[model samples]
Target: MSTPSQLSTNADLRILQRNMAAALMQPLTRHDGLQSRTQVDFITPNDRLSGFQRLEIYARQYWFRLLDCLYDDYPALRVLLGEMRFHKLCRDYLAAHPSTSWTLRNLGSQLSAFITEPKARDVARVEWAQTLAFDEPQKKTLHIDDLLGADPSALRLGLQPCVIALRIDHAVDHFITAMKKTDADVRSGASQAMSQAPTRAAIIKAPRLKKEVLHLVIHRHENTLYFKRLTREAFLMLTALRDGLTLADAVELALAEADPTTDWPVQIRDWFAEWSQLGWFCKPSPQP
Candidate 1:
């Protein structure tokens, strides 16, 4: 460990390692550092594939597995592109985008942008949304009783992870909505007409369990992302509260949205009932 020569050798080795990695990354072309010493080992006459071949297997496997994860996550995008074209897309993507993510989950975070290129925008819009829908968080649900005298001071709201907030343009939103409404009609011999009007429907935030269409915050009771949609007003109220608004203030905001004439107390009661039923709020029962 104290040898200066060894230290110098290590620095040289690191430089060489970087160069070697770069060469392997690029197509079979020459690079400065990899000039005459192109490969680590030369292929012997009898040996068909060299040591580099054996080493490359690992690199190939890494790319394949990561790409496979992307495919599994973005099947809709793949379908839109078709098999051969999808393969080309993956090829072009991998070479240009190298694996920059620490986890495969993060791998496709930018895939939406990747597919949003001029040629791929149409399908990218669909695929990116799907990917986000799949990865959104799931939180523990707060039962109905938790919404009493909801004081923001000591209250902590547990939000469902699967709850997505999408602000889509009218055209894409409408296209998606129309697709959903026509699933049954499509099979029933109804003629299809297409129009660009934005409709917002929750994608499959929850994978299994009896409930599937998202309109609310998504939670995982045991295994699936179950959603309980909140009315727009209620959602806004919670948003304010979650961001540190006092219970009284949040209630004021909520009551204002309900109806100018509706009694605030009554509105709060009714809203609490729904919030509790949806398991959207959790109150800490034990006092300090």
Candidate 2:
């Protein structure tokens, strides 16, 4: 319906809009803004701002918005790294892996791999799992009665959608708990006096994190996420079940790896009962 000139003009406008959007998504800089301005010839200068300056505003906002989303997703990581380092981490991560999803909730999905420090990466992994568990689709939880009539040896249990098993080198769960407590104290009036005291020079000292393997099960219940510490044997057992191992095999593996001095059979029985009551497992899949 349009003339050739009008069609050509419309095509040019589309190209310019795409170029401006791509520029805005990149990290903002004077050089980048100047390069981006060259692609769009139609932007007009206002009394208060030049055309490039206006474009720069959008560029800055784009970065800030994504940065804020990353910050919110990994608050404990920010606390561990401090403000400046965390900002640098976020900037470098964004540069390496830009958001590709429509939702900001997925902004930090690749953060664990992007982080260089092992401890920071572990924390990111745990936080990412928490996010995933929170958003996981709801499924019916399995109860003790569901397994009462079945042969325990042949049952292949399924884990709840909200369950996540992680093994990390540091006690990140404890660190997260401490950081959350500190934040809560600051938010309340309890820490007002301490906050008002004279500030000491910021010392860049790394906290002495214990270097030991920690097995953890993070799950959501009653709309709250709980971190449950587990022994190596128990963790292995759960992971085996999660990977579709038969109940007999998972139990045998866990018992074999358990401490000789401990009453593993009793311990496992209690653990299974407790976990089942807590809705950690889903309905067992049909026997093959």
The number of the candidate with the highest TM-score is 2
lDDT of 2 by residue, 1-288 (tens): 111223358776676667777667666553334344343334568999877777666666667667767766777787778877887898789878888987777889999988879988998998888887776755788887787777767788898878899999988888777655221111111211121211223534445556678998888877678889998888989998988888889988777756789888788888889899878898655557
The C-alpha TM-scores of every prediction are 0.52, 0.79
TM-score of 1: 0.52
Candidate 1 has an lDDT of: 0.48
Model 2 steric clash pairs = none
**lDDT tens readout by residue for model 1, 1-288:** 111223357776676566456545543212111123345442233367665654454344444455566555555445445565665676567667776756665565566567654324544544454444455544555775545565655555544443343222223333333334221111112333212211223333221112122223433333333334555566666665555566667766766647667565766668767656655454322334
Off by over 4 Å in 1: 1-13, 23-46, 51-56, 84-97, 100-102, 113-141, 152-156, 169-221, 226-288
